[model samples]
Target: ASITERFEPAISWDQVARLREIWKGAMVTKGPLGAQDVVRAVELGCDGVYLSNHGGRQLDQVAHPLDLLVAARRAVGRKTTILLDSGIRCGADVAIALACGADYCLVGRPYLYGLAAAGQAGVEFVIGMIAEELGRTLQLLGLAGVADLKAAGEGVVRYGGSPASRPGDTGDFGVLQ
Candidate 1:
């Protein structure tokens, strides 16, 4: 409740402009699920926008990070960077985020799982596993590289409708979409 109250006002453009003078390193604003907030961030000269619902730990009924990627991409266009951090468990999820317009996706629980299981070695193992899986996923999707995944677009990542009945839809194309 306290955190919710504190965030009620949201950050102002003036505040970001002021912070830009002091913070020399990269500045990324997170926790927004709307295009307007993203536009504001870009206007303020933010380095990037990290799209997140705090893993759904902050609020309920928040749109999935992948879903937000579409609107964010349209709002920011291709030049501005976009990152996602929510419900991404494996390489497949990473692929979906990228196709949906996310430049990069952040995984949180996976790292924590690695840490809880076996410290640094576990983290290394997890990273290796994800990398291998991502490579395989790309290959299976007939993609040559991460850049190729973007070509898949929303056609590869479906949310909750019947695949065949999706009007003009042909088939699953082997991905979630």
Candidate 2:
């Protein structure tokens, strides 16, 4: 059987193989390029990577890391500590990141305002807000517990990126085609 036929809840090399096949043809580099950059990064001894075009805010228009995250993860294999932190703003986003294969995430702007707004107190407030919002967000999705979040995607996807040919496909933003 093929990789798809071997997918398991525990996830295996077969599952990873399937992902690579689907996304290998999808990786892209800056403004449309080749796949060598990704290969080069790994060969250079980088243990992990984060795919981003500076959160799309810097580029004005670019592919979402969500698409690149999957492709990148598959490119490097499961051992890589792949982390992504662009355009993530909600608890649902957290789920999406993990689903797309982010080992860790980074949220940038939220803390800046808290530091500027009320110093330490403001920062605490922002933390609380994020926690409350994340919990509520997960609760609404029937994921009352964080562990339950493992089964994300529910097969529901919101895709984008011109390089990505599928409906929401945005392939890879900056990666060389």
lDDT to native, each model: 0.77, 0.56
Clashes of 2: 16
| Every candidate's CA RMSD | 3.8, 14.5
So what's the TM-score on candidate 2? 0.60
Q: For this target, which candidate reaches the highest TM-score against the unseen true structure?
A: 1
Compared with the true structure, what per-residue lDDT tens digits does model 2 show for residues 28-89? 22221112444455454444555666767755465566656666666666766666677766
How many collisions per candidate?
A: 3, 16
Give the C-alpha miss distance for residue 28 in model 1, angstroms: 1.5
lDDT of 2 at 124: 82
Cα lDDT for residue 39, candidate 1: 86
Error of 1 at 85 (Å): 0.7
Alpha carbon lDDT at 121, candidate 2: 92
lDDT tens digits by residue: candidate 1, 78-159: 8788989888788887777787788888888997899899999989888878888888878887889888788767565654
